[model samples]
Target: MPEAGEVAARVAERLGTMRGAPVSVESARQLPAGASRATYAATLVDAAGVPEPIIIRAVPAAEDDGGLGAEAEVLRAAADAGVPVPEILDVGLGDDSVLGFPYLAMNFIGGESIPRRILRDDTYAAARGRFVEQCGGILARVHRIDATQTPGLDELVDPVEALHALFPREFDAMPAGLVLATQWLVANPPPSSPGSCVVHGDFRLGNLLVDADGVAAVLDWELVHIGDPVEDLGWLCAKAWRFGGATPVAGMGERASLLDAYAEVAGWRPTEEALRWWELYATVKWGLICAVQANRHLDGIERSVELAAIGRRSAEQEFDALLDLGVVSPEVVPDPLGVEATVPDEEPHGSPSSFELLDALAGFLRSDSVTAEMSPQVRFHTRVAGNVVDVVRRQVLLGATHAAESAQRLAALGVADQRALCDALRSGELDGTDEKVRAAIAADVRARLLVANPKYFAVPHP
Candidate 1:
């Protein structure tokens, strides 16, 4: 919660102590790194007028579960095992130390972590061509790190059980899709690991910084843990991480190319079915994660329009999991929000109604006049704000109809609500494989997308 200037000043003092020399801050600013933490890019000027750039990564003391010191150790282990990573300069674990939070300082590595530029910009065209092979090689190296030697690293739990606990907690109740996916995962476990090794819990385009040549350095070590090496590959290929790319491997290359490169480096390749099982598990994991993010706003942890909008995206992941498990497909029903209905000139509120004002706000937020001069973080938030406004507008238009339909479908299945329906799935009274259950799930997902993101329906299946 400190100001940017204050954070920069602490960095100067911290690095000064590390080097046993005077250091002064030249400049510092926050980067739009991740949803839950703060990352600062800072420059320090020595008394001799030499300049040095570094990265300061901080998590709130309340949220630093795996001590930042442990993360720093993992980074060193990763680098020693041939993985490209930023050099860790120092770490602070005490609340009163440095910036008054758990944090780490590292030498800065320059590259683009934004998927929009890396996937679309001409500057990274060559990177796009080689991302698959390079990512595979990097991930293989990541899995080679010896977790036993790494201090404070969390031993992997049963991933499916972890997700099962998370799902109902985040949503306040489980859905039929969750029960279906859980049963599928339990009944169809993947092959045992080659041996327990490191898994980068989140290894996708957002964390891989790519320069013109290729991946410059791997960033974000907070999620590193001891787990099956295949977890990294599955997390990478999750549909939710594709970020609008056409291909499956972080939108950069084909699945086969990634597996081939990984096989060449690791001396083995997982069966396609094994990979698919892991991928499905990851899809379910991401869905609940989106809900957890939304709750960060709803529960007042970090209120932001961005998180609220992302809450709706959990439905898309649920939809994807069902499609993967052969429980449902993208139904081609006409979008209800696309209706060409005329509005009454004299509305209940006024001449220019509440809906009209919402539309005006959305348009203004999206207008270049408003966002052209904003910082990258502000600009991204502005876009999300605009999308969130549209979601509100569409919900106002169709929420009641969607609610009625959901209730009717639940009643038809002899359940009182979604919660009861989920209970039925568990008791074997209602089958996930039944056509009626699939129909209800598909309809619920379609309504959600109609409000959250209508275009998601058009994203070709990988």
Candidate 2:
């Protein structure tokens, strides 16, 4: 990865050559939230002395454009169709000399993409007020885009099956809740909308740029493909994307309003069953993605506490899938992670037990005095590291209890373990729709979430 100054220099060189004048790098900063590419927001000044702001998306030389070249073409088509998207300035898809890799540069649009701020901040009251309608209208436009305008749109074939295949590949022992969702999904596949259209493979809060007025630009076009457009709408409605908001539509608005807005623009509305099916699919897909991220840490590829913490969050998606499947138990589990359960008087791990030490560390990391001067990124990671410690602490306190209970549930189901339970569900040897099967799976998921994210239990769901 190149440093900030190197990115600025490269941006200056590329723009200078294109503008036929000398250009100077004014500034460059790394932007958060891109998983696959290193993204830099940069400023450059030409001989004319006007500052130009742009975003550079790049991959290593070894990956060579990493499908970013295709994304640029999608942006151009989307822009032509009246969708608010970044204006592409230059692309080094076929050429890499500028940055020693494939790159895409675009004129940057300033906006907030953070879900918490976009949903809660008074600064974005107007955007929050109109998010559903605006996002629906934007999605309707996104779906209506011509696939012929971009050649590779058809490459992502049958996303539903691809997701089904990906989940098993990521985990040695699949969550029982997800197993039920998979069984249900495979048994009741939703019929795709009549004609194929351009689907923004990921269209949700984090990917949508918002200003006070409303959504400013639809970002992250890398997932563009030819598929059922309802996938975009359904993905937006997934509870995982809601980020604990009062409403389900990106946690900012209602689904009815979104459908009304989309119908007004697209001249059609997806059936409730189709929307439900796609939303369930989206949940399963996200769980699989969580597994992938967690595996990256466990496999020694990234070695991040954040990644390890994210792996634990797969339970969040698992629980959400069960919620969508209507098999979640009405009984709520108490928040287990935040509780300060103490060690025995005869401390086995010696003075200041592991759990007690973690409690102290978590407290210090969260102290305003400690975090007050830290940068936002550092503070965020510090918080994550604190959570990672908390997870370990909770595991130490509750791991055996949870494990015994999980094993007991599995035994009641005539399965030896999670892998056996998941295998039985997948092979249809065990009835996923059975009340006992559903209840056992739900209990296991609740236990996982209780340890991984007890606060997640507070999030309201249907």
lDDT score for candidate 1 against the true structure: 0.80
| TM-score of model 1 (CA atoms) | 0.94
- Model 1 segments more than 4 A misplaced: 61-67, 165-168, 328-339, 342-348
Q: Tell me each candidate's RMSD, in Å, in order.
A: 2.2, 2.2
Clashing pairs in 1: none
Whole-model Cα lDDT of every candidate shown, in order = 0.80, 0.80
Q: What is the lDDT of residue 224 in candidate 2?
A: 77
Candidate 1 C-alpha lDDT tens digits along 369-436: 99999988899888888988888878777777889999998888899887888778878898877888
lDDT of 2 by residue, 89-114 (tens): 88886655487787888898999988
**Model 2 TM:** 0.93
Clash count list over all predictions? 0, 0
The stretch of ten residues in a row with the least summed lDDT in candidate 1 is 328-337
Superposed by TM-score, candidate 1 places the C-alpha of residue 85 at a distance from the truth, in angstroms, of: 0.4
**TM per model?**
0.94, 0.93
